[model samples]
Target: MDANRTLALFERLVEIESPSWHEAEMARACEAELQDLGFTVTFDGSAEQTGSDVGNLIAHRSGNADGAVAFSAHMDTVKPCAGICVMRVEDERGEVLCSGGDTILSADDKAGVTAIFEGIRSMLEAGGPLPDVWVILTTCEEQSLLGSGALKAADVPQGVDCFVLDADGAPGSVVCNAPCHHTMDVAICGKSAHAGVEPEAGVSAIQVAARAIADMQLGRLDGATTANVGVIEGGVATNIVADACSFQAECRSLFPERADEAKRQMTDAVTRACERAGAHADISWTLDYPEVACAEEDAIVRRAKRAIEACGLSFQAVRTGGGADANCLRGLGVNAITLGTGMANFHATTEYIKVQDLLDDARLVEALIAEYAGS
Candidate 1:
């Protein structure tokens, strides 16, 4: 592959601002690029559901060999990514790509996108036997895998194993386990009263919420489970007793039952606090995404290991506390595993990836295609 050409593609993609729920420009660019590569690209009808300007881009190309493989990457980036300026710096560690320090480089998935695109270009130039390939570029992935969750199974071709190129680590690292996530919104209601005159008449919802939070065992519940109360909002003024309070919390665990148990315990804590404070509590819990665990011996994982080794990288299986598009794809019955894109400090202003890592990722992609093609 042409290193300069690949770097140019990465720079162009990072230059485009594609925050969650607003990825039309990036989607259009990807569509045009795939079309230029002789792939049949189409958009799914998930825009309305995902509330994105455009649906997921699903592109397909026939191959000269048997076996079908699918690759996935999200088009959305976290906030504060606007006005991004990519800079290439050479140091003792070799070439590294970074933003201007005022904004994120958006290399989280753009690096993945660059690798996939350049890998395909290399394959085409070599004119070697290849497997049938499908590329799915999704939007709103920064928002709890919204894009991939909204994707319809019918839109994806059958009998195709999926590979998600959106993990944070070295290029050879594979995310084989991710936790199930559940979000909870709790509202505590109580009567208001004058703080100075008749403070005794009011049931302080703030106190109730504080009590509930104190009673709950939050943060690092166990080896695989964790709970956190991230947001809290309530009360009108300090003069009057607090009437209502609301908080948003989340629980995550590698096992679904553990996550559910954590939710139940938190709910019970809220109930006990409300009962003691004579306040009414309203708690709602929703499962954001299910946990995904792919065995190292699985066919897709084996292929990934082989491909990584072929690129002279050590294959390391990892478990993540975060979620990605792979979670939704696995939920949808696609055999999927997430591969690292050599991103470091992602979602931060200091995010960067080594240029050599980018080239190695592209080579890994090519190796994967060849492995699937039975070459």
Candidate 2:
């Protein structure tokens, strides 16, 4: 691939702001690029479900080979993505990309996006045997893979092995294990009273929440299980004892049983805290996405390993505490794996990608497609 052309694509995409539920402009740009590459691009009907301005982009191109390979990436970024300005820094190791501004660099998946396109271009221009290539650009992936979860299985072509380019490692890293995400919301009800006049006559819901959180087992409980409370709200003012409190908690694990056990432990902690405070507890749980467990012997995994090795890079399997598009794809029986795109400190202002890493990632993507094509 031409490094300058690929870098231009990345910079152009980074200039466009595409936060979760707002990927309309990004989708348009992707559609145009895909069309220029002789791809038939269409949009899925998942906007209403994901609340995105646009749906997922499905681009396809036929080939002479027997098998098909699909490359996937999300089209959204986290907040503070508007007005991004990318700056190139010269490091001894190589050139490094940074925003050098208040907002994040948005390389979290824009790196993935441009890498796939560049790979396709390079592979297609090689004039070798080719396999059918399908590109699925999803929306709202930052929101627990909401866009992927809303995808219809029929939308993606059947029997097309796939992988997601949305992990945080160098080119050859593969996320073989990913956790199942389960979230719980709790609401505690208590009696209200004036703090100064009758403080003892009422129970503070915030106190109950504090008690429960303190008692809960959280923050990497074991090798594979983890839980945390991320959102909490209660009370109207300081003068009155808080009558109600609500908080959001979540647990994730590579093992389903372990995730379930953690959820139960969290719920029991809240129950005990409410019991001690003489308060009523209302709780609910939602399974955001399922786990991803791809064995080395799996065809897709084997192909990826070989492709990475063929590109002269190290290959290693990893487990992530977070979720990816692969997590949702597994539930659809697609069994897509997650591949690294060298995005460091994603979702933060310090996010960056090494120039060498970007070139290597593109080469690896091209190798992956060629490996599948039997070329």
What are the runs in model 1 whose C-alpha is more than 4 Å off? 49-51, 79-85, 100-103, 157-159, 191-204, 237-243
Best by TM-score: 1
Pairs clashing in candidate 1? none
How much does candidate 2 score in TM-score?
0.85
TM-score of 1: 0.87
TM-scores, one per candidate: 0.87, 0.85
The per-model lDDT (C-alpha) reads 0.90, 0.90
Model 1: how far residue 67 lies from native, Å: 1.7
